[model samples]
Target chain A: MEEKPVRLDPWASAVKLEYDKLFRYFGIKPFQEVLPRVSQVFGDPLHLMRRGVIFGHRDYDKILEAYKSGERVALVTGFMPSGKFHFGHKMVADQIIYYQKLGFEIFIVIADAEAYAVRKLDRKKVIEIGLYEYVANLIALGLEKNKHTHIYFQTNYEKPYYRLIQMFSRKITMAEMEAIYGDLEPGKVVAALTQAADILHPQLEYFGGFKYVVVPVGADQDPHIRFTRDIADRFENELGLRRPASTYHRFQTGLDGNKMSSSRPDYTIFLSDPVDVAVRKLKRALTGGRATVEEQRRLGGVPENCTIYEFYVYHLLQDDRELARIYSECKEGRLLCGPDKQYAAELLAKFLEEHQRRLEKARDRVLDYVEPPEF
Target chain B: MEEKPVRLDPWASAVKLEYDKLFRYFGIKPFQEVLPRVSQVFGDPLHLMRRGVIFGHRDYDKILEAYKSGERVALVTGFMPSGKFHFGHKMVADQIIYYQKLGFEIFIVIADAEAYAVRKLDRKKVIEIGLYEYVANLIALGLEKNKHTHIYFQTNYEKPYYRLIQMFSRKITMAEMEAIYGDLEPGKVVAALTQAADILHPQLEYFGGFKYVVVPVGADQDPHIRFTRDIADRFENELGLRRPASTYHRFQTGLDGNKMSSSRPDYTIFLSDPVDVAVRKLKRALTGGRATVEEQRRLGGVPENCTIYEFYVYHLLQDDRELARIYSECKEGRLLCGPDKQYAAELLAKFLEEHQRRLEKARDRVLDYVEPPEF
Candidate 1:
């Protein structure tokens, strides 16, 4: 048998697949290989890394090695301010905050330029969302404001950062860019170069000298990671740039068992969603329950296919023993879907209620975190 | 007869054609239509405009009206720092200095980014040439340093200037870009957008509010002029931008009667060339004289097709009477190629000697005029 290559589109709204293909075809190492090392280097692994949510990596071991040697390391990531901040975004935020806690420098980009250019969103609306939604949520989720943490809007960054985009364009071809991002438009070309700058710029001397960089992204964003790595290689001699390490996490499944996205509001839960509205969406979520109560009790529930079980594993429940308890009960057919829905809804409602309070305060402090573009 | 559309490549060095076709095929109006108006609005016109060396225009009448009304108007132009400063670049500098004398704000861009990306020049070398060669020569040509005069490296400009590049890409398509530029690459796409930004950014609110802008370019660069005008139209509502007025000038003929370019050192003369070498090259220049002395005496020389006549008209003799005397003498076969070459060389040596003296003092003032990018 021959292995088939997989193509991933970072701009696509829905991306669902077996992630093992990333290892077999794309050379992404399984994150589990470094999970124990992460625990040894830092005090504890991020929940996402420990529980297999961060499923794969490319050179993440190098990031761990740099950290262990007491060398500087930075985590870089970006958010498109096209919609409300959802649970899928929180997965990325968790890794960022985790890295910051481990004393890694953090660089967060509000991708307002990408939203306006690629998504055709209004510039004012994009900036507004970038502030009130993305930056605010990150702050509420424990992204601290300190010298080690730097956040900026893409359109309002430093000159050298923009220079990287212009300089990187020299070595890469339109064909190579099209191979990673389908269909070439002027907007997509600029946006792709801008994204590469966003990832690799932390190492530039203008951005406080070179530091080992690691980006935490969803599996679909591996294409951008791959493209940026190539750019770093091309510029290594000219700019003293090195390829950044990256880890790919699985997407948070939607309520109906599809990909969770802010575009699909009915199936996605936002950090800002009202308590009752969120619970309503959660109660109706698809589960691993059989057609009937009797059938579920006889066949044993398939937690692997359950959205509610995924919520507990990915977000709601943090204690491994408790998550395991729920897993075995559901697997043995002792727990029913109705009670599981009610329980999961209670946990989600509690998290959102507390988060909304902090988000309200975070909204007032967005300017302290990042400066928006003047225009 | 139906007229055929003409396609132009700005990157191509050699551009030769009948100037009337520009009026017939493109919307560029004969500059002669605005010649008398230039004298009325800004006192005496530049020698280039007076002698029809600047032969075509788009919306130049609007620039005259703005100047007459005492409204803010600016002259924006750029130089690719891939080579030494030559007479072709000096022609552009004359227009910038001419506009500055009329109290028009000056915006000169050293296209270091374009040189590095499109021409693959070294970063340090590009910056060095941009500072010592481009900026120093402009200062020596009497470019004043004041609040109204702004010179910048394309890679080292402010945030909003770069923001315009990102925003302009949104409304343009690859096919539309390819129509203007022959084949598309990442470098070319980025360079095009950066060029558009360079032309239009003076009107942005971030750059001291809006001002009427005029760019003086060689005839081959009309493609960029047209593309920038289209961008200004698309961004009118969003960015409060208006189309810039522009003037088209004939390229200085090389010694061999081809396009004068720095790439052909034997034919093109650099401003920094030693007097002896410059004179030696000039002595070997092709002329429009008859094959034999008896034939030249009977049938007058073709002064219209002569490179030596072009030098007097473009640079050495600014007086209308002196230029007319040379033109008639050459046409009536009174001035032979040998003596004409000696006269032109003496004039060239004297000019280069005086210019190089000022150039030494101007080199020290380049840092005061523009800040070079730190790589």
Candidate 2:
């Protein structure tokens, strides 16, 4: 008899399933209580009904409170052109489009320098190739060419832009650099200074006055923002520029029951994946239940721990009631992995069709955002 | 006996006088050595024979060797605006004009920042007041407006101008900064860096290449340019700027045997001094001779070491042969200090006639140079 792939730890998968939920997994209190406050401030800007991808936040509640008191806040995000875009990044765009629709002015920095430095590219070709891929993909998503959204490269500007980056860095302590960057090599230390400079750049200058800046990133970058907050007041004084409210949002995983990454092609469906390819990847994706269909029907499956259900939670279903129904049905054996995968694939494929069509028409529209403000 | 005046030490005065003779009093080397070297690579851009108030040089021989071999070189100098013109400064204009006549692309920086930093002025009022004084003084001194003479403020500009100071600083050990700046305070490191940056600022960025630069400065700055040369190679490397030849000219002193400064109204004969005021100041000026008139006549005044004769050589008198005659006659007691003073005053008054007239008419021209370059 052929031995089945043994069901490894489901708790490990539960940890993975905890996308926006990871902040709760990690015990940060601010992220937990922020949604109601966010809703109070902007009245569900995206009409999100319930939070979808945002798992964690830091000081988000304070920002929301400030906003409800009629304070202005801006949002910040970043993209490093390391490789092709996939569904994981599409979710990032979806969240951005949502928040942006709610009225947050956004700063999206394309990390060409950091990307090139880390990836070890041929220096001569760095900007041309990488920037093209980034610009195209960003437009492919639902990002609008709005006045409030600034999409810029890290090094392509002068004046109020990187000028604050320089002045802010002048006040940063070396001890602080160590905390944000870890035990950095000399090159990494320089990179850390640049990174620290980046966090301060947009808020301190782009809008003249500081506003709330929300960073949508994973757990890896929390250390950087934490260090930024510690030094923000001092850097503001030294730079003679305004500071901003800021927060972060972490996301969860996809089909292959691991971190949502394209390293394993079957792990993520590309935003441009063919309808059939999308369907097959989702259909074959792992499930958390007994092997034989008869036995599975009798013994309830673990809905909270299933990767297939994670796709539905992160992507397909937004309604909390619908999600609860799906969750209960799966646990009761009324639903199965095959149907869940098919539903997610259909939603994602439909989303991709509109996205690909929008990508063609929005090329010039996205390029228009690159124009600098007169002042 | 009547209360004796509280007399200062003769030895202290003598020591100061001794040091100032070859160094301070005659800070710039004789133009004989300076101009031809400048003319070498510059290939005599200015048609006239190189000579004037902008006299004296250091390492001009090496510069000539390079210049004659068709290597380009640069020139550096400045004007300080002290409200009115002086014969003392008219000579500086003459010197700068002579160098420009010899094909040197001169960097005439108005010492506005130094004046503000040292003098402590209101920022809003300073630059305007300075440029008015500088432009009038320079044009009066007959600075050729175009054809390679680009005058700028010390406050504005980027080029090989200030960056070389930092670039070359790595080559300079702490021993150097301490020696020159004298236990530089922590807060003043930026000032020292500015000093270093200044040495190479003219060569910085995409500034057209220069092979040499000569600074026409007061003797006090010898320590700076000497340090500049010591680190020239390394400064070139760090800055990504070319290394240019440099010379430091010692500005001559006052008729009253003291350094020429704006505050010591009597010490420096203003170019705007009614000729009689200049003559009167020259009459009361200190002499490097015995107290008795007979003794001074017998010994001949110490012309080489005397501040009065130093001015004649550096300012009023241009012909080397005539200068040699005055020096020999004065030291031999053949020419009296009283008559020597009168001769210098008369000669300077005649030379400054047109410059004073120009200053009277050209104060408004200075403002034009204050705007941004059309890059």
Candidate 3:
């Protein structure tokens, strides 16, 4: 029998996330069965699903049904613009782009309010950084700027949004707030409600009320999804709100083979990182090789513990058969860490060049994608 | 030694308010010295100040200094539209009118946000009742609608106001929120911050930042005033905000002799109350009188405990000498309960008729007095 690792709070740094255990721990259903069916609906599942990054879900069957029926639905996700945009952020961007292509209404909330409240950034700076660092990167990653997509700052959507926050607040109590977000600072209280507002705003009457909604998030953000789902349930009878479905993706490993932390520049390959810098970072990244190249050839390697391998699985590789071959080669000592690192670096540099090109284009028409509260 | 009656939470029904004890209990400075001086500046002060209804203050000297120097200052107060407008509401209205005449810029917030958050009223209904029952009554009570006066709903002024609230929330913590409002429901948390925003809003750049400001509120609302003043102090270094000054009023006693409650309609003489209903309610009111008329002549009436006497002092009489005579007559047993009740009934009826006339006119052009947020 395999010994299971104890998963700590998902938000903590010690969380060496065992994604399979999280479904049972969080009382969420696994997404394994739904992926193939959803793939059939979308013709081909995105690389996130093909690579098994999206491992868990809650109420995702409703979303699958909406997709099958060609229902106008929404994909709601938010970003706190407090730090550099990295591969961890790219995971959400990729999912947003993939889902938008599938005709889902997209609401990308640049949580300027949350940035100001929880992260202590000024609203103007949050907006400026959000547009340049996060939103620009998102648009670069092919999040379409069209009528169906809305990217808004949390502070700008004040009128209908705050009133709607007030409405959601009626169901939530202080005890619940403390439970969801410990120690309940005033900013955290506002941020939590504002997030609930962000999730629910897409379903407001002006945006076409009462439709299936889904959020794509790393496992750390499940608490907010759970809180929002509870709020949606509270409004189900009155506002006809659907409890939001969520798909939880595995955390993208940092260049150091630890969880990506924005505070540690060496740990993240920021999207804005120069191609040379990214290549340098990847070259120095922790890998799964043994002490000597001869020993790695004899005893094989641990791709599971390799940040370079994770970069390939997460961002670089697209073909499932090719990824499988690389995994087997690492396990069997056919591949060396040196060449694997070099290959991943080249792939990253190429990806960054393309993204930077799109980012430049995204800068010009940024306003076309930005939206205010519909009400 | 004088026996002190236990006063319940002023927001609750069991409050048998011993108004004098409130100064020591709330740690507020007595307004006795300030009153006569303010009276000299504003010509006999308002009847509320003359009769000692305005008993305590925090930094009210700033207001007096503004008056003496002819400074363009602000008076900020808010009303919760939870019920019909009554004499308790009238106390704040009377002060707004008095200060407006003294050349202070007046900002009256119809707290539709607070009414929804704290009172659980629907926003639409709160707006409707706020206009018909509260704002209309304030206009009827001689609160002038001019370029210097701005009346607005808390919900309508969402943009700059919420950003300002975000600014205020940075200084206020969850512990302070619980201390001020107790139990810390999400609605109360937002409501508390909204009030801080309301007070600080008058000192914003658009309204002329940093001048003398005062809010006239019942003693129960002193917590919000205290909270806002602390927030104002926190911003004083950066924003040049003056710590808000406040004048606290004693609660208006109901016909049943407890503090007036919005839920206990029978205990209140609503400003919209019909003449016959007002007269009937007055007839059935509690009075500080002897059981028999002959015994009342020997003992005299306790004007201190008389609801009829309180009605006259708080709302009915404008002349200080006339009010003094009524107090003397009640103390001398010349003003018996039946006759005192009858006299108050006539005064209330006449006041209501004149108020109804103004309310009719205020109803027609109510929007002219209302303003959106400047920012």
Candidate 4:
């Protein structure tokens, strides 16, 4: 069933609303270009290339160098955890898995504190359900705990991050906020201020001080990425902290002609979806080609605007030349949207099945990595 | 040299300046009655009373109750290692000793961070001088390191006090400051709020919560005390933390009739002062009666205005009856200001003598009590 646009928090600062500005700032054509570079930087040792799917990145090469230098770069991601996980959850989980093979750390924050502060969660339940949801997914992702990733909530009060917050509060002048938020209304300024604190919090103490941290987020969360990086730059000098260069990756879209969101079940094909259910979902996938074969032959298709291609750009196939071949053939009416949809559906099902097997085997091994870090 | 009366900060609230209004709001009397009650409240338990002499308190009696409850309440007091010891310095040290006997945990924050924040403090000299000033005095005051007090600075970021600051900031409303301190000029509002965070930061954690705390301080510091108590009151219902109290005392003035400040050498007699030197200083102390004994016999002296009685009142003397007897004798000119001064001077010498010996013996003992509290 279709519904109206979600009521976005006016203070939440939408990522999609600032897309053009961000693209111009980063010198990227669009988010699609950033996805392909993930494979190159991650080092295609397994070579998941079927077609050119992923696109562009910022400082992807720098993070790649860390791997070459034997310094591990962590793939840091987070969940708001206000609700249950769905298809988009599995998509990000799969993305984390790809990086784990490349020997990167996976740092996942449940963001329970953020969720509680923002959405007004009952403090007691904030961690309970979310921690379970998170650990289960990480287990399903086949993440080996201490080695591959750490899934932690941000409610740790005794951490040195609290000290960093104290110090951070001293450095930023009211003049800065007056210029930016314009006399931040007291209604919830601390929460807004804490958003900056969250990204920089991990850098202050013994979390291998300021190494390459990549935030893998959906395109909608780009505002947080941009805001956090700005805070990191200012805080780095203010704190005299050893700050490593950071980058943000934006995932493309869903099966429908819109952004992928957990709340929108129809647009997403979850990793756990049965093969028949996946096929039916893909049949409804939005395509860029002209309606009929007669009209499609005369007019080239708009693959760039197609949501299916966007998903591939963020996830599935990786070979650039193969993607180019498919696009060109479709434009020339050599390959139709229906057949392409079936290929994507089958490809996704096979990947999911293989992932499920890996997840089942790696579940117990993940617990050790989740423990507190020693100094 | 005497400096000009310090000008109040323009951003400070009118209500904040009207310390009497604060007294009324807190259901406490004006500072006049409050100052004298310092030692009287905790009579006999402490070897020497340093109530009005010590003068300022954060939560003086709540801490006493906490101490009496057989709760671990270390007396926490301190000074920034600014310069050599003075009489005003001894006032605080004496108060710390009183609380130490009452079985409260004592923490002496050298205010090193405060020194750095307010003025330049040489890092190399800070810890050294702060230690010499506090550790020795604390020992002389009968502070057993294992039993009495622990002295530290604005410690590493690991301090729980920083966590308390964070919690305090979230609860206090900016409107409360506008009400308490009044209108602030542009951009100064946020920094105006940091004082509440600084003064209220005491590290005490309880069973999934926190403990009661107190600060004994002079009336002049009521601004900080009010700010901190406001923060505590603000968060009392929200965070489930105990509301800390402030014990306000009227400070002892210099022999020259000004605030008994360490900044002036003569204003305070150092606990480290030699017995003969202390007696000589007392001989020169300001007197408020007739010049000659016979001339003063017809005219009653201002015993209420006398600093000698203030000392006896502050440092626990034989009794209040002794103070009343001395007051009657001085007012009727029977007890000349000279003899009265002589008596107090001798009392102080003996007091410091015993305290110095105890301090030397208790040096290593204080170190053990200062260990990080177990949660």
Predicted structure 4, TM vs. truth: 0.70
RMSD of each: 6.0, 9.7, 5.9, 8.9
All candidates: interface RMSD: 0.5, 8.6, 1.6, 5.1
Write the residue-wise lDDT of candidate 1 on A205-296 in tens digits: 88899999999988888899999999999989989999999998888999999889998999999999989989999988999899989988
Which candidate, 1 or 3, has the higher lDDT? 1
What's the residue-level lDDT of A101 in candidate 4? Answer: 70
- Identify the leading candidate in terms of lDDT: 1
For model 2, what TM-score is found for chain B? 0.73
Report clash pairs, candidate 3: none
At residue B346, what lDDT does model 3 achieve? 88
Task: State the lDDT of candidate 1 residue by residue for B20-91, as single tens digits.
Answer: 678788899988789999989989999988878888899999999999998999999999998999998899
DockQ of candidate 2 is 0.07
What is candidate 3's CA lDDT for residue A259?
79
Query: How much is the lDDT of residue B100 in candidate 1?
Result: 93
Residues A23-109, model 3: lDDT tens digits = 667877777668788877887888877667777788888888887887868899988888888988998888999889888889889
lDDT of each: 0.89, 0.57, 0.78, 0.55
lDDT of 4 by residue, B201-268 (tens): 44333211254666666666666666666666765665544555665545566766666655776656
Worst ten-residue run, lDDT, model 2 chain B?
A: B1-10
**lDDT (tens digit, per residue) of candidate 3 on B1-375:** 142332211122222245556666766777776977886777777877766678778878878877788876888988888888888888888888888887889988888777776777766677887778887888778877788898887767646677676666667788887887777788888878888888888776756555678888877777788788788788787566777888887888888987787889999988888888888988899988988999888767777777887787788888767777877676677889888888888888898888888888887767667743211
Individual DockQ of the candidates?
0.79, 0.07, 0.45, 0.16
Ranking by TM-score: 1, 3, 4, 2
